[model samples]
Target chain A: MTVGIVGYGAFVPRRRIKLEEIAKVWGADAPAYKRGLQLFEKSVPGADEDTVTMSVEAARNALARSGGVDPADIGALYIGSESHPYAVKPSGTIVAEAIGAVPALHVADLEFACKAGTESLFIAQALVKAGEVKYAVGIGADTSQGAPGDALEYSAAAGAAAFIFGADEDLILAEIVDTYSWTTDTPDFWRREYMHYPRHGSRFTGEPAYFRHSMNSARGMMDKAGLEPGDFAYAIFHQPNGKFPMRVGKKLGFTNEQLETGWLSPWLGNTYSGASPIGLTAVLDIASPGDLILLTSFGSGAGSDSFVIRVTGRISEVQDLAPKTREQLDENKIYLEYGAYAKLRGKIRMAE
Target chain B: MFSPARAWREYPQRYRLEAAKCTECSKILYPPRLVCPACGGRTFTPEILPREGKVVTFTVIRVPPAGFTEQTPLPLALVELANGVRLMVQIGDVENPETLEIGMPVRLEFRRISWDGEAGVIFYGHKAVRAGS
Candidate 1:
């Protein structure tokens, strides 16, 4: 029983704020942010959009690409996010209901910083492999928050990616060759319950956090699957900033071309949990049959979830069933100034 | 601060766009009513509204209601669906509200409407975005 991706989709908000806009508001040099972080701009959600809404739209696109699979057949659903709208309610339930996958599915909200999204994917895949569920959906989405004047403010953005998994042969878009997760209790970033923004350990988030975990996970997964970096056609890693993924991909022996198609952080900014999954969606939109792709995601705390996937022949049939990821990123953009962005993000105080 | 009542009552309307369609005269009614004004028919079928439509008319609200000030100058429109049912919804994804025309095609998109004060239930609903965008 080989379980694989039946369908996949992504949603990126149309509103953008250039790094210069955010930097000017804070009296910082815009070129520094652009050069250092490799981020030019970031997406901003409207007054009417958030993690839940973005997830719903992405899931609808996923369903559209699923070759008309019945939503009722989805026995499980999970949403991973750092910003779960409500701290108590399950976003998974809202997404499942909106996608017409409700009344008979297991649902939950997961939080593990950025890697929580891939965690849901690993679990849903296990359930399918065990024959516990005929199909399952996993979503990574965030309208991520960054404190004003903080380094995070430049890259934190909004987006979502959804993937549906099943064993049905007719619907398989990519086969999951293997998955590996490396985790440890290394606290590089955290936010208290009442705090509006998270505090990072600065340089600590670099070495021991993202680099160690991601490198170990990628190496471990490749060794476990008896494959190397050259064996894969493409490689995607968690992109917290535009620079980290490229640097890490090089250290892993993957060429620039292998990482190029999925490196969207420079253009779209880091989407936190949505980062790597959205990158994979971009690759899937163009990957050929029999192409092997490696994906690894990192979250502060810290951990990395790595997967070796083989694109199937059916990919071309459904890749265009929904809007392409690049099309959404490139077309019809509405750029906002810093003031409007702050107001839309609720950074400005409102009267009671 | 979350109100279970508000969430429960509007579930069908917000989530599934459930409306009422009079079978006698084939008139589509939103906010599902028991009686159809056209034929005085009490018999109606549960209809789910189409997600795409054409803008019939619109207004730009420069002064938004409280809790909606961030969205000032918002574009609201009356949309006529293919089913011949017309409904009012907010327009989004536009850079300039003034560029909107009466017959511009649009599609429904689910989004966060507002929250109950600072710490309460966040309401979610549909808004219109330009088609193919």
Candidate 2:
């Protein structure tokens, strides 16, 4: 059974806060941060936008391109996010109900920091391959939080990407060639139960966590598939920043041309769980038939999920069915200043 | 704050935009009324209202009730859908309330309507964003 993406879609909030805008508030050097992280602006969720809401919209877009797959027939759905709106409640139930996938659906909310979205994708495709469900939806979304005046604030952003998996050859746009996951208990970044924002180990978040896991995952996946980095038409690594994906791709023998299509962290910021998944959506927007795409996503608790996808002829037909990821990233963007951004992100304290 | 029962009862309308169309008169009723007022029809079929529409009329609410203070000057509009169904909904992603005009085209998007608090139920519904945006 060939389980792959039957439909795919992505959603990014219209509002953006530029790095300079955030830097001006804290009196930090904008040029330095920009040059260092290779990030300029990040998507800001509206007052009404959250992990669950974004997931719903992304899922709706996925269903739109699903070739009329009845929402009721979706047997399972999973949403992966670090910033699920509720601590105890499941975001999947709300998403399932909204998309008309209820009663006969198996749904769960997954969290593993940034790679959570890929986690959803991994599980969703596996179930389809196992003949457990005819179709399954995997979504990665987040309105991530960063502490005030922290470096993470500049890149912690909002966005979502959703993929519907099925074994139906007629519907599969990108057939899954192989999948691999590399995980270890590395506490590079974390937030306590009651903490409002996450904490990182500065440079430690690099070498040992992101780069190590991502590199290992990509290498292991290529080795297992007996395919080199040069064999892939496009390669997407977890883009915590614009610099990391490019650097890691080069380290793994992938050219900039192969990595550029999915390198979205520069302008879109790091959407945690949505980071690489959204990048994959961007690549799928313009991918050619038989294009081989390698997607590797990394999370801070330390894990990476890599997928080898072979695009089908159906890619072109469905590419125009929904909004493209690049268009959403570049066009009709509503930029916000520091004050408005603060208010919308709930950084400002309200009167009781 | 909306009770769980009240919110759950309206899920059909809020979440899916489910409406009832009169079998006899072909009139659409949002909130899916049991009886069609136009023809006094007792039977109706389930229908989904179109997501795209034009603003028939709108108002900017400066002093909103609780649960809406964050979105001060909230722009609410009565939009007439392409299928001729009219409904009132909040205008989302509007940076300036002054930009809202009569007949401005819009598309409804799922959004968080309201919530009880940090730990309470978060209500989800559709809000109108400028079409093509």
Candidate 3:
């Protein structure tokens, strides 16, 4: 039973808002945001884009990279997002139906803040490993919200990543070596039941929230897999900002070259649940056979899900079957000003 | 709030573009019905519409509908697919709506149609994007 990723895909909205555009509005210096946060711009979802729509697109791409897997064969579908468009309905149902993975499927929407995406992946992988399903799709996506003028405004962004897992050895592009999770009761960030925006506990989101959970989960997974930081060809962490992932990687003895390819926060900003999943997609786009990749995701409620994956020869056969992650992130970008950004995001009130 | 039944009923056309093709006359019916309008044929084969198409005509909506005010000057177009199936869809990813012309090649992209309200059901459907963009 060699259950692992068969195909994967990513979706990044073309619209971008420079840190300077956001900084100028709140009277904060643009240079400070760029230098301190290590962020230049963030992707913005268009008026037509949301967690659900982005998830559908990413899932379609994943199916394309799947080397002709029938959508009808997907036994389970899950989507994780902090910014699901509908507060009540299931995003998984819409995504599954749109991608033609309906009728016979188990579907649900999961939320654990940023780690929500990988959490779905964790579940889907387990289901395949347990032989409960032949194939499962997991997606992490968000049109994440930040208060009008908070530090989060600089990083909260939109994107999605989808991964399909199966046990067929012939189609496996990577093999799941092992997985581990570290969780605890930490209130580093919260949003009221009906609040439009989330509030963070400032410095608390750092050491006690993201760092504590992420580091432990990564180390735990490594120890369980009997591997070390130096053994992996690529290591990616949940990027709340450009700084945290690099810092955590360094503290864990991972090198800059190991994290560089997946370091997209500087350009794409923190896509919440899509953060680590999208980073893993970037790494997969370039990784070769025999490559070992470690992925760790952190959520504000404070938990991390870490996985050790070993790339297989099938990677090269399907790597170019769909659009590459870098191609989506780099091409056809449309820069937006603060006013358009505000309007696009529905931060402006207009008569109904 | 829109009824889930309303959304559910349209799932076939909205999700997979499932249509009815007349087995005898070869006429394709979008939103497949019990009887074909062209040839009065009752028997039909299930067909999925081609995703690539060309804009037939278009309009720029400066004053939008209730939920569309955020994207004012929205470009909506009637697109004709390769198989001669035509449908009205919102044109996206264009920097300027006024520059749009008939016969502009387009590819179908699934996106959110509109929000019912602040906390309402989000309608998802197909929109048109400039091919290769």
Candidate 4:
């Protein structure tokens, strides 16, 4: 029973705010921020877009590429997001119902900072392998937030990616070769209850949090799968910023070419849980049969989840089934000025 | 602000664009009427309408009602689905109202239609975006 991704899709909001737009409002140096983060622009969800809506779109695309899998046949669904619309209400129920997988499917919302998305993917695939469900949908989505003038504001963006896992060999687009996770109670980033935005440890988030966990998880995955950096065609690390993914991938003995395909943070900013998962979708768009891909996602608590996937012959058949991730990122963009971006993000306070 | 009950009752149409096709006359009724308007048919089968369509007519609402002020100048359209069923929907992802024109190809997408408030249920429904987007 080979359990793997039967279908995959991604959704990125069309609205974007460039670093200069945000910097002009804050009276900061846009060039400095761009040079440091290597991020020029980031996505902004509309007034109506959120984790749930984006999840539904991405899941629908996944189903489209799934070769006619009925929505009702999905036995379980999980949505992982740090910014669930409601704290008490489960995001999974709404997503499940919207995708037409209600009543019979087990659903839950998982949270582990940025890695929440991959966490859903990991559990979804495991359930299929255990024969607990014929198929499961795992989604990572976020309309992530940063304080108005905080450094995170420039990069905390909105996006989502969904993957359907099943044991059906004929439907598998990418077989999951191996997986590994590394976790520790490092408070590199956090937001308390009722807090509107998150706080990070700045420099501390680098070496100790993102790099340590991502490096360990990638190495552990390689060790478990008996493969090396050279064995994979592409490697995607948790992209907190444009610089981190490339820097970390190189540190792990992977070449620039191996990491380039999935390094979307330069143009997309950091979408938190949607970061590496969205990157994976972009890589899958151009990946060839038998191509080996490595993915490592780091969340700020902090932890990292890594997977080694081997693309199957069905990859080409489904590559154009839905809107490709890069096409969403590059085309039909609606660039926003700082004021409009603020209104959409609800940064402007209203009279009660 | 819509109550949860009101929102819940319309989930089938709002979330999935579900309709009913009369077994006798083949008339498709959105909101799934209890009885077919044509031929007096009570028995019908569930049908999911095709998501792609063309805008038959449209208008830009410059002064939006409450709960819709954020999307001022909202473009509402009468869309003729691929099945020839015409339904009214809010056009989404429209950066400029002037870009809208009749007979433009469009596709339905899931989006947040509105919400009650900070503590109320958020409504989700389908809205039309430019086709191929």
Candidate 5:
């Protein structure tokens, strides 16, 4: 039973943030956000959508498009969320029930910061390869909230994606042929339980957390898989910003084209959990079975995961919102003031 | 607009306006490049940029990113330092952006560009101030 993506779905919230709103408040030109940061607009989550809700939405669509899920046939359900609604309860249980994955399915949450979603995919592939039950769902979802005036707020956005791995003939959209990983005891980024948001050393996140871990993992995976850098048609990684990916590509010799395929996050801010896997779904929508897709992920606590996937040519299309591409995300505007940003992000709470 | 990554790459250069002056030629590299463009020299010598310079050009930004939103209506100037190094930076303490001149004197400043979410991890980057008359 080869494990791969049988179905895939993506969900970016309906609301969009205008580039000028941020500029007007900062008393600066919009060009900075647009040209400097390379961010046009990012998706804003609605009141009805949280991590679990978005995850369910994407997973449900993925299941529906996959020709209906047996619910009981799934052996495991893993939720990869950095912005989980609850700190303790497993988001997996909530998502499994809402998506009807039912009991007997292995339920767990993966939280390696931004790498959780990509890591969850590997786990699902392993379980399926071992002939566990049959189908497994991996979901990466985030409604990332950044502090006001901080670098994270403007770019941080909301989105989610789900990928299913099963043993059947409709089988994986791409098989995880090889994998590699790297770890360093560095704190490039971390969010304490007491803190509502994550803290990252700006330069540190780029050089050490992102560049080092991702490069090491990708090279390790490439070397292990016996594939050259140019061999992979497309590659995707956990996107924290528009610049980091570009810088990393310069090091790995990935051309502007290969990097463009995974650039949704920077223009949209780091979607925390959804940053990477959602990108892969977008890639699958356009990729063919023979296309080689290399992937890498870097987490805050300093961890990286890399995988090589070969498209199956029969990539199933999953449902999505009104926007065909994230490029149109700019048109769905609901530009907010700082006060509004605070409220939407739940920074100020009313008495219950 | 300046993220930490951009800040670090320009750290010392940002402080004293230190930049690489290609040893092969007197050509001034404002941001200090490892590889010299003028003479195709691989190694450049690091030197402090001249403090007094004229604004070669400038633009006013009504919109800014996370760290710059508060400084909206900000003027950014491309100044040619005393040493003839041209650098683009935020020009603060200017009362009127329209009154801005192409050869305005700009001084260096250490400022907070933005922070990460949740009120911590301040990202420091360099900005410019109009030199006192």
Candidate 6:
């Protein structure tokens, strides 16, 4: 019961925030905005967007990537997001309904901050292999808003990514060759309730939360699979910022080529829940048969989920649903002023 | 919240229609970051967006979010500009917010999206002004 990606999709917001605005307002010489935080500008969520809409957009693409399979054929649905719209509502259900999946399909949400998407992937792989379901859909999305003048705001972006998994699929982008997990009391990054943003120990999060966990998990998975970094063509990890993953990739001895594959967040921000899987979706867009891709996910618990995917020959004729994901992102966008950023981020007063 | 270095390091938004561009990636980013979302370089340059686009898609909200109940049935739109950037905004002078279409041409304008009454913070967001002469 081998498990692999049968379809894929992505969604990035169509708007942007200018870097100069931050520079001009924060300070001509704001040290942290300029030096420590490595974001120039990030995607500002639109008022209409939330985790649910982005997930819907991505899931639509995943279905298209799967050659427009009938929604009823899917057996499971999962949504991963730290910035879910409601505490009590299951966003997965919203996505399940929007995508028109089987009414009785398995539906649930996974929360692990940034690693939620990657973790969902690992679980989906298992469920498919166990024959618990013939096809499982995993979505990662977020409309994460960082506090004003807070470090989180600059890199926070809105977007989503989706993966449809199944067995008996002729077109396999990658197989779950192996997996590994690692954990520690890494308090590197966390956004507590009653607080709309995340707090990180800065320098500490890098070495501990990101580098240490991502490296260890990748290595453990490689060892378990009897493979090495050299065996894979590319690697995409949870990117809180552009620098963190690069640091970890170097430590794991992955070359610049491997590190170059599908770096989603730098422009998109952490998409929090959507981060890693979105990166993986990007890998599926261009990867070839026999090409191996390595994925590493680190959540602030802190935990990691690593899975290896080897593309198969059936992948060549993929319908390319990633384009719609890219189209929604690449084609059009809105530019929000600081005030709008605040409103969409839910920072301002309401009419009620 | 803007990270100049990040604007340079990542460019998924920048190069691909994200307004802010980095020296290395020819990318654009809005709400620009400290580093680029593309090249992973810590160097970044700035770019403002063109003030025009079209409604690629949109929906009307009779029941607004926490801050928009006063403007119920507001015609909100998601637009794509001639330059190929999409925005979420209110289409001013809309006859029936519910009747808005997916490809109506609209221009960009600055308007109030929300207000911070407690702090006297007036929030501004992108709005889609119906395109005219």
Candidate topping DockQ:
2
What tens digits encode model 2's per-residue C-alpha lDDT throughout A1-352? 7878989999999999999999988999999999999999999999999998889888888888888899988999999999999889899999998888997999999999999999999999999999999999999999998998999999999999999999889999999999999999999999999889999999999999999999999999999999998899999989888799999999999998999999999999999999999999999999999999999999998999999999998998898898899999999799899899999999999876
At residue A196, give the lDDT of candidate 2. Answer: 91
Candidate 6 per-residue lDDT over residues B85-128, each given as its tens digit = 55566775343465467776675533344543433333333467
Ranking of all candidate structures by their DockQ, best first: 2, 4, 1, 3, 6, 5
Backbone clash numbers for all candidates listed:
0, 0, 0, 0, 27, 71
Per-residue lDDT of B1-111 in model 2, one digit per residue for the tens?
889899999998899999998999999999788888999998988898889899999999999989897788799999999999999899999888887899999999999
Query: What is candidate 1's TM-score against the reference?
Result: 0.96
Off by over 4 Å in 5: A26-30, A316-337, B1-133
Please report, in order, the local distance difference test score of every candidate based on alpha carbons: 0.89, 0.93, 0.90, 0.92, 0.71, 0.70
Lowest-sum lDDT 10-residue window in model 3 chain A: A343-352
Q: What ranges in model 6 sit over 4 Å off?
A: A28-36, A322-329, B1-133
Every prediction's TM-score for the first chain? 0.99, 0.99, 0.99, 0.99, 0.92, 0.93
TM-score of 5: 0.68
lDDT of 6 at A92: 79
Q: What is the C-alpha lDDT profile of model 1 across A166-242, one tens digit per residue?
A: 99988999999999999999999998998899999988999999999999999999999999999999999998889
Residue B91, candidate 4: C-alpha displacement in angstroms: 0.6
Q: Model 3 - which docking category?
A: medium
Question: What's model 2's lDDT at A349?
Answer: 90
TM-score of chain B of 4: 0.94
Q: What is the DockQ of candidate 4?
A: 0.78
- iRMS of every model, one decimal? 1.6, 1.1, 1.5, 1.2, 20.2, 12.6
Cand. 2: chain B TM-score: 0.95
Candidate 5 structure quality by residue, lDDT tens digits, A221-303: 88888998788788887777777777786689888888777678655667877887878777776676688998887787888
| lDDT-superior candidate, 3 or 5 | 3
Q: What lDDT does candidate 6 reach at residue A247?
A: 71
Candidate 4 lDDT, tens digit per residue, A1-352?
Answer: 7988999999999999899999998899999998999999999999989999999999999999999898899999998899999999899999888888988999999999999999999999999999999999999999999999999998999999999999899999999988999999999999999999898999999999999999999999999999989999999988888989999998889998999999899889888889999999999999999999999999999899999999999999999999999999999899999888888889888755
Kindly indicate the candidate among 1 and 2 with the higher lDDT: 2
